[model samples]
Target: MASSYVEELLRQLAEERERADRERERANREREHADRAERKLAEEREHAEQKLAEEREHAEQMLAEERERANRAEAKQAPTTLEQYLRLIQQRLVTTLLVESNPVNSASGSVTAVNEKFYPLELCRWDDFEKQLERTFIEISSVFSSRSLFPSETDILGVQRELSPTSRKDEQDIRPFVRSAIEKPAERIVRAYYDLTNRPEKFCFQNNAYSLEYRDPETEIERRSPSKRRSPERKKSQPIPDRWGICEEEGGLRRVCVGEYKAAHKVPDEEIRQVLDTASKNLFLEVLWRKQSGTTNSEQDKAKELVAQILCQAFHYMIQSGLLFGYITSGRTLILLRVDEFAQQRQARESEAQYAPATQLATFALLALRAREMPRDWIVQAENCGIYQWPLVPNPALHQNISLQPQTYGGETSESSGENDDPNDSDYGASQRQSRSQPDQQSRSQNERRRSPRKRTERSVGEYCTQACLLGLVQKSPLDVSCPNFSMHKRSSARGKHPITKDDLCCLLRKQLDRSLDQSCECLDRKGFFGDVGVLFKVTLTEYGYTFVAKGVQKANERDLAHEMKVYSHLVPLQGKNIPVCLGSIALTRPYPLVSMAKVTKMLLMSWAGTSLCYNTWPEGVDIKKETDKTLQTLAQSGVRHDDIRQSNLVWNAERQRVMAIDLQQATITSVTKRQASPPVLHTRKHRKIARSSSHIKGIVI
Candidate 1:
């Protein structure tokens, strides 16, 4: 029983060990599967996160596109009403102010000024105050916009705020209300100023003004007597026009009688003051009118007349006030009155003057008139006329140049006229004498014409030709030489056959020589006529019927005349030889000119022989014939080769009587390499034979 129990225990132990091993193997497999699952899940999570990010990016891009579209749509909308445009104007004004202030004050100062001055004014109704504000705003806005004060992304409103009154506080503080009201109009006024004052002759307000004494026409009175004038009677008193009453007060003297009683035209000091005060506006209008009319002399004249009238009215006012009588000396008043009357008369005359001849006069008259009506226009017109227009009031410069007297007005004028007489008397007398001599000179011219008779018949050719020929002869002769007896010569020529004169020969030779020289020089200078002996021979033979040749007179005999040709054949062609051809044994009467043996010998022995000797004696390497032949052969080959060829070794064999090339012993053989197979050897002997027969043959021992 014990043996059986032990055996059972062993079996149980074996069974338990096997089961535990199996369970351990199963757990190991489970962990490997879990690891694979975790890796897969992580990859999936990563992909999902990437997808979410891409979707978010797409949504943001869509939103951005929507915003851009909205901005473009808004930009297209227009603002029509004043109220609707107020915001835009305000914004623009602010921007302008800021830009202008950038070079001056801080941005904040500009913003503050715009806000205080422009914003409120723009919101208000369009009145003078608002208009002025608008003008200022426009100017400020323009300045800022021009400077690109706002970023591209920023709207106009944003730019305005950026460059508002805050940017320039100091400027905004002084006359704050006026500044605000005039800001818009200030721009208009500034633009007007630029336009008006653009030229050197422009009428500028700062340069011109109505005199303090100048009065309105409504306030001016006519003076019948010099002093202690009585009031005009009711019948004589002129009623003030209604238009004049608009700005004038008429309550000085009740009445003044004319003729029997002393009638003084009166302009109270107050009226003068009023006119002077209004002159600025009136002057501006006048300038505007002149500008509109395009500144013609007529317009200028009209402006001057208006100015003079205005000044005269002002002066009259001063006279009535007794200011001219008390403060101004009589002499000065008289001068002023004279200048005034002169200006008035000029204006009246210019108005009646025609356009053509009176342009300058009208211009001056207009300028003078402008001085009174529109002080600014007057100054500008005077400047345009090249005159210095100064203020009529007390100025140091004027005082230095002008005389001031204190006698009665009319008496002072008389005294000044007497003072001016002495210097001008002699000049006046001289001018009178000159004027009286004019008629006598005219009578003398008439008498001279009457004494000389005129010819009506046509001039004869002989007479005309004789005179022309005589004049030409005189010109050609020395100044010291007396004029030849042309009359006697003319009579002799008419009595005989018209001789071929020296002049006729000279004229013919001049034309022939000029044409021949021109042709010869052109051929020599341009056509390479002397480059080759062949070309030289051809040109000489064709042009001058002369050619170079080396030939024996008889077979086996030395060359009698190697180079010879007739000097003249059908035509005389230009030859290139240094010496002209000698005409020998060549009958001019013959149909075909024949050259003589002696002449041929001389030409050949002289020029052609010299040329051959020089060619033979040339340095070995300097042989042009050999060099030229080598050059031609090398050019014919299809490989790299040297071009150092020349004529020294080349020779003309007397036996062959043809040029030949020599000295090929130092010639380099240019071998062409081939990709597929060795290139075929060129048969140079065959080419040489052909080339020998060709123009570039090498040397043959003569």
Candidate 2:
């Protein structure tokens, strides 16, 4: 029995060993299969990466080749004609600036975020815009000898492609790219107009984007009405527009036209379309979304907010800047806009005129399109089907620009504008002078005729929607007038016609004591300028047709006005020629429109001094620096040593055709001094230094 047990035990052990061997063999086979799968995956991943890299390289190479081809073609063609060159430039810009081959339709989707200030604007579309200014723009450009209007293709491509891959993906900093792409093209093209039409006035472009465009507009209306209240928070460091159409004038580099640009991604084609009235046949139109229905359609509200966001900024900017032609664009669509001064004024008088009665601080913000304290929906058209025509595009004929003097990039030469005038233009220029003879008649006719009712429409951008339209505005140059509207010679030549004595001035306030001040005088500018202690207004006395800038201050700030008065009194001899002629101050019987804060009771009238000097270069035969220096030197000799000497102080007096130092409110009287209209030079046997200086001598005893 013991022997049998041992044999069984050995057999059991043998069986156990065999079972272990079989398990080991199975585990080894499984390991081998797993390793094989792992190797295959690694090999496949490596192969895929290599293929992707190759594809990327090929795409880059092909793009480079295409760019080379485009460059070669541009150079080889050398399109000499202005139209041809412009077309080529437009094509290249289209290729560069417009990146969306097929933008997403956003009209039905999420709205873009922007600070919204809802305002009503009467938009007028220029139906025959092609005929408004010297027929077709092509013809206007044709008059210019085609010099190199286009930047070199290589340079253009390089600037256009400056966008980094990260920036393209991020899309936050797209304005620079858009500006770089179009600024040079539009500017170079416009140069021909100035060179050909206003010869000796060099055409240039200024990036006033970073410049101080205007002071913070008084936004009291926002506080008064909850419906019109919008967050006034905005970028404080920069100006509104991205680009400026500047030309060298005697006063400074004049801001002719301005443009507001947006990132294509931020302001998509669909959003622009959403704002436009597509039901009509016109190419351009204006939209003002007024009144909010409590019935909220999230989609429509988003659109309304978006449209207001995009337009309110630029609309207010153009209004304040006083420009004949201005535009807003996102690479996909361009909308040309013109401000009808009379129409805009009428609208204000009829609609938002209540705030300007001057019951508070001179907080005059441009609430032009906005409705405060009113039942909503005044700007929007309810088609009776609960369908809202949100953005109204105005189709008004592009009228000739009047006069505006914009502050230059340096803030040294900031020329304010007259109603419907260009910033660089003074109302006393060629246009103003020609119309001066019949000033009352012309103004009356304009004031009587309201803006055409044909202005607003629910229309598609149509033909003007193309990027080519961006280039088309290049021809809307205000080249018909002299480069510097009221420079030295022009002012001196027209001196006889202007008011000499205070009584000679055509003052509406004095003539119409029975009527309200607002009714009697025409407000050339609502928010013209903010002085140290007083607000400056461009006004036309309606009764006798006296146009002068009124320096107004509230009753509280009369002390500062006294100091300014003293300075003017000291420099009395330099009045009307070297300095602005002071028309005596008047206490207001009633509040004025747009500028009456706590009833601006005192107004010191003075001839319009052209804006400050900013440009190093002036129009041919003009030396602004020399002229201004002489004026300052003369001021120093006249007991009044103008302590403040800067470009801003040196005002270019267009009426007198001289650059005189202004803003003497901060000036000091250094000593008791005396001067003469024409000091009798003592001509002795030996010629005195003063006698030898050939010219009509007008200064202190030398």
Candidate 3:
């Protein structure tokens, strides 16, 4: 206020200035307070956010624990079937032997797994089993020599370990060495039987030869491993089998019998009806007996009786070993047992008219016994055969060593001998002398010339017509020379007695209306990677497409296929998730039977996993690294380690929004802990999707 009116104005001006200063100070304090409030709000927000994050983490952990508990409960509640039990036992054995010991459960787990496979241990009663058992014992004895019949050598020479006798009952866990030893001899005998029967192809044994043993009787029972001291007794002894056979397909030699050998013994019953009832036990039992001079009939009868008892014991072995078609013998009596219903029916038919037990038992001991009786036509031929007689004469054309033409049952000699020793010449000498006097020889020669057929200079259309007929083409012209229907004519002339070759069979197929009767059809297309493992083909099916990987007679490929099949089969529990579904396998033979085909190709049919996933094309919202880690974790849980986890081997399913692992042919089954060694992300490329931070930032800037 302009000097607040002079004097009063001077005081007013000072007050005004002081008021301005106070206002400025008040504004400053208010601004400071506002800044403090904003800082406090930001700090509170950060603390609240951190607390929320921790809660989220804690909740996630709880959910995971709950899921784990549920899974454990479900597993415990699930009904353990015979097949599942068998698979469990197999998995345990394979895991223990082939994988590391840390991740796997203790030895007690193996005992428990085996116990589950045969919980009841009761034999399924079959009327045919007895006859089949007896026959198998006889057949095995006949095939295996007296020297190879017994296992005394193996039992005495095998590895031995010391165990505490007092703790035997409490020892639920079986040492790898101990379990292997217990099963060795029985397996060797079984293998020998399969080898002799020429049926090793039908069975697959474990890759490792089992070395079972007994407790060292020499070791003191009271001696125990000293605490804090390494004992020499802790060393494991490995005893080699007297004879061990290895599976060329799989490189292991464990005691467990698998594949067709296992399949043959898995019988279907009320309790176990899931598996196919194809049990045709190939049981083998041999009883060694030395040759005795003039053995009495009574002694022979006793021997027969002993064989019968041995037959029962052999049957027990068959049940235990899980085999169906086998042989049983007691040095003298050999019987072949085919446990299928057809064999049983045949045996019944053969024995229906015969009433002697001695005769019945004797019949059971015959080798190469047909499942069906001999054809009636053949029986008639055998009954009506007659001997023919020929006159004997000396011949000039015969060698000096050769004597007069022997009296024969109409058997012929050499053409030169016949020409020189012509019977007609000797008989017709008088007639010839008379004809030569009358010039009738010239007339006869002219008549012979007229009767002789003219020779053909070239092949006619008739020969070509056969090929046309093979193609199922009808002859267009009736006047054309009609060749004999080779298929029909051969069948009629042979009367179903002669065996038809594969070529003949193919030719005969043309007569049928249906062109595709074979189980495996011709490959319509072949494409993809052909490597040491197999040749992969792209196949088009009626409903969907598939990858047809053909392993053509390559042992390594076969092994890989075997490994794949094993892995695939074991991962049945993981279908429709991380692994491509294996449709099945087709064994394509080269227009011949498996035994006769020189080269056969095995084609694995798997569901077409659309397109391979790469770093560049990882699906939207899908974390490739996280998903891969989860997949690897699942595989590890199954004791599998996918060694070949490459982009090419991973397929993307757009609909499922998942990645599937393909080409498990090169995969390995290993311990869970061991699996950790294999990286979850196998290969990294320089693709933009997974570029480094610097590159990404630069790219963004650009």
Cα-based TM-score, every candidate? 0.17, 0.42, 0.22
lDDT of 3 by residue, 386-437 (tens): 1001111113242233222122111222222332331101110000011112
Q: 1 or 2: which has the higher TM-score?
A: 2
- Total clashes for model 3: 36
Residue ranges of candidate 1 with Cα displaced over 4 Å: 1-16, 28-32, 35-43, 46-54, 61-86, 89-702
User: What lDDT does model 1 reach?
Assistant: 0.24
Please identify model 3 stretches exceeding 4 Å from their true place.
1-527, 540-556, 591-600, 671-702
* Top of the candidates by TM-score: 2
What is residue 356's positional error in candidate 2, in angstroms? 43
Best by lDDT: 2
What are the per-model C-alpha RMSD values against the true structure?
39.8, 23.2, 38.5
Q: Residue-wise lDDT of candidate 2 within 55-142, one digit each (tens)?
A: 9999999999999999888784453445444444444544444343334522123222323321223333333332222232434445
Ranking by lDDT: 2, 3, 1
Give the Cα error of residue 572 in candidate 1, in Å. 79
